[model samples]
Target: MFTGIIEAMGTLTELRRQGEDVVLTVEAPGLDFSDVKLGDSIATNGVCLTVIALGDKRYSADVSLETLARTGFAQAKVGDRMNLEKALTPSSRLGGHLVSGHVDGMGQVMSRRSSGRAIEYWIKAPADLSRYIAEKGSIAVDGISLTVNAVKGDAFLLTIVPHTAEETTIARWKPGHRVNLEVDQIARYLERLLQGGAGAQAPSSTLTLAKLAQSGFL
Candidate 1:
């Protein structure tokens, strides 16, 4: 798991295609891989990729075709900058929300405007993904966890402060730029639990104090 807090930015140094999959070598000069062993997981732009080879300032990983199809990496190229984060340790602070490093879908930046020292951006997510997003909820955009300031249709708004803009790749975002998006993990599981399965009936009415008292649960 991760915290969606970007530790550094890494550059895609090289990509080699092998059948339907590809091998990627990233130049992560800011990351110290001294203790990282083979098969360690790393979050590259919110996608959990296993480290196949560890070097002083570089590491290689294999990206599957499914991952490429679901993430913005389908159009990624060498020299592209990627947000990087190491797996969370037990002692690590939960600075950001829990991130699984699993991209739910791709989102496009619809608009951007300057709001004093902050920048407001509107991102349009996939139609199906819109249901999982909620106002004031947490969402990871391009691997940066941000709170949704508002939600309209299939799009959401975010306010990025100067510190966040400078620490990550959001500074390079534009109106048409595409980014990897990961919705809150809790929301997805809650939906599944509530939906249950066939023949299972969800609560017919909303849970309230009066209803709870009537049901003798309060």
Candidate 2:
């Protein structure tokens, strides 16, 4: 698990295709990898990747076909910047929301503008994933944890402060840019629990306030 807080930005030094999988090599000069061993998991742009090889200032992980199909990695290339984060330890603080580093779907940047000192971005999520998003909920965009400022049908707004833009790759986002999106994990699980409850005559997808009150979630 991860906290979706980006530790550093790494440069994609190499992408070598081997059969159906691609090996990604990143140069993380500022990230400490002295304690990282083989099989350790790292979050690269919100995708959990296992470390296959390590060097003094670099690491490599193999990307499976499923990951490439579901994430922005399908469009990634060498020299692109990647948001990097180490897996959370038991003692690590939960600075951001709990992130599984599993990209649920890809969202597109629909619009961008400045709102006083902050930058406001509107992103359109996939139709199937829109119901998981709520106003004031948390979402990980390209591995950066952000709060949803507002939500419309299949679209949401995010306000990025100067520090966030500087720390991650949000500054490079444009209207047509695609981003990896991981919706709040809790929301997805809740939906599953509601749909899979026993003794129900029929499975339901509707979420109601009365149901929340009965479930002690209100």
Q: TM-score for each prediction?
A: 0.90, 0.93
**Which regions of candidate 2 fall more than 4 Å away from where they truly are?**
197-211, 214-218
Per-residue lDDT over 69-116 for candidate 2, one digit per residue giving the tens place of the 0 to 100 score: 999998999999999999999999999999999999999999999999
**CA lDDT, every prediction?**
0.90, 0.94
Worst lDDT run of 10 residues, candidate 2, spans 197-206
* Pairs in clash, predicted candidate 2: none
| Global CA lDDT computed for model 2 | 0.94
Pairs in clash, predicted candidate 1: none
Per-residue alpha-carbon lDDT of model 1 for 84-156, expressed as tens digits? 9989888999999999999999999999999999999999999989998999899998888899999999999
> In model 1, which regions exceed 4 Å deviation?
198-218
Best by lDDT: 2
Clashes of each: 0, 0
TM-score of 1: 0.90
